[model samples]
Target: GVPLSTNEDSTRNQNLAALYVLPQTSYPTFYDVRLFIDPGYTEAFHGNVSIRIIPNINIDQITIHAMAMRIDSIRVVSDVNPNEDLFSDFTLATDDTHLLTIRLTRNITALQPHVIHIDYVAQYADDMFGVYVSTYEENGRTVNLVTSQLQPTFARRAFPCYDEPALKAVFRTTIYAPAAYATVRSNTPERRDSLKPNEPGYVKHEFEDTLVMSTYLIAYLVSNFNYI
Candidate 1:
């Protein structure tokens, strides 16, 4: 339930009862997401997401949605001047669930595109939601499958995003996992896959960029299930 708006603009006038349904102040046009899953572990699936956004007005801060995820680092830089406008201030808004605010030292020009890069780790929950773990019995042994079911507003549970249907963006997603241990799938077809150098028993699978779609439509899964 992330909305985009400049800090100076105060136009969230929707009866004040449905503040959660307000439209975003910033719009995302494209995204590049990378994920690493260790199914062997019980928690902490790492991920990195890069988003290209266009704001309606000049803004010094950008806000998105996230829940039950630990943000490791956030880097925001203008495409025009990567070194000049780097921001370090990251905090949560008051009394808001899944709301993440990033304050930049300088205001970003309106209608221009800026890249927001985020590194975070999310837990694989037992419930089916954003990147959860599903279990089954294989050959009399218990097995776990790490998967996702981001529908409606659950995308924030996996990675930071607008987490609304109004915001549409193209996505390029990649996954890294132990080779031959699991199969990776996403919204788009796999573009390529290869063994990761210097890391044995690991492989990287890159997916083609998705058509412009809402965050709810974007998905990925890591599992050992075979195509029968």
Candidate 2:
């Protein structure tokens, strides 16, 4: 049996929450995210997310919320000046804290907008949670569905984000799934694929840019549900 500690040092966190949170240093303004998930093959999901942020102070470290994912590459580019990359290196604090610390070779000045682009592959939620699988009975057969629940602090389980409730921002989201799952849903309606890719056994579901909202407000589902 495991011993339980009654000490305040074991319980008290700096953020006054169960887990640590983003420091709001990089004030995120908008997010452009794309996910490639095959419902038939649900072992893992591949995706990328780019966040436009305005730091209020000059800092070399940019920390964001991330959980249950592996980061492949990261790049920081100035919004006003895109001539060179601003990213130096990155490290993931994958404890219960779920913070990704990005170190920059040079400091990003105050009030300047920069975009952080991250490419990674992430695993599906273990349980009925952030992008997990559920089942439905249809004609004496079980059908698997892929969906998401990004309430409260669960958005970080789906992607790397500033998942705080007060950090509201616009979201431009896109997804890739099998064509069999005709029903795809997001907070906003699906839009036409202006930049459609020629991926095999997959179709694109692009959604209209959502109005300014917190990360937890976003929802996505992919299933061949028999509905209008």
Candidate 3:
């Protein structure tokens, strides 16, 4: 979480346990996420997420959760400034800080909204959490399937976001996948045209915006599996 106060702030208690919890300086209101995954050709997937957040107080740093991924870029957009922020991750570091910290040159005003944009890439998880690939036999050949089980705290492994248990936001998600051989499913049914000239042989599945909900409740699946 972002450091909202300096050590001299006597009103704030710097307890030892505070290190384990995220500071609620800024919280997410919405998430717009797009993903491209072709399980037939690669194990890694690419994604871009834009998050809308509101600051509870003027803050110079923003921290959110992420794990086991490469964030190619991150930027904060607002009337104040549109430049990118310097960011670092401690997902695998000794502090057990799966937090992504973005240092800002200017402070974000309290109650003002801004968008945090990030581009990232990560391999499909083998563990049951987050977005992952599973296999099944279809006509004597192994077939790859993509699915998610983002309950509790695993959504960070899928996309960078405010991942605390109580943090909730509206989510709008999209997926680009093989058109002819794949079926996509999400919380809502809002599939669109299947072909794009720029993305040949791929289909677009844009889900409707979710209700105000926790990140863990966001779910999706990509495969040729039958819809039941």
What TM-score does structure 1 among the candidates reach? 0.86
Best-matching candidate per lDDT: 2
Poorest 10 consecutive residues of model 3 by lDDT? 85-94
Using TM-score, rank the candidates from best to worst: 2, 1, 3
| lDDT of model 1, residue 120 | 94
lDDT for residue 124 in candidate 3, whole number 0-100 = 76
Clashing pairs in 3: none
Q: What is the per-residue lDDT of model 1 for residues 1-228, given as tens digits with 9 covering 90 to 100?
A: 788675545444544435565345688999888888867776778888898989888888888887787889888988888776567699854555567888888888889889999999987755777788777898999887677889978888778888888788898888888765567888878885532233446678788888889998877777787861
For residue 119, model 2's alpha carbon misses the true position, in angstroms, by 0.8
List the pairs of residues colliding in candidate 2: none
Indicate which candidate wins on TM-score.
2
Error of model 2, residue 122, in angstroms: 1.2
Model 3 misplacement above 4 A: 1-16, 79-95, 191-198
lDDT to native, each model = 0.79, 0.85, 0.79
All candidates: TM-score: 0.86, 0.89, 0.83
Candidate 3 per-residue C-alpha lDDT over 1-228 given as tens digits, one digit per residue, 9 for 90 to 100: 997776667435556546656788999999998888776854688898999989999988888888778888877877455564523322332355677877776777899888988999976777888889888898999998778888878888789988887888999888889875468878877745433234566777887788899999888788887764
* Candidate 2 residue-pair clash tally: 0
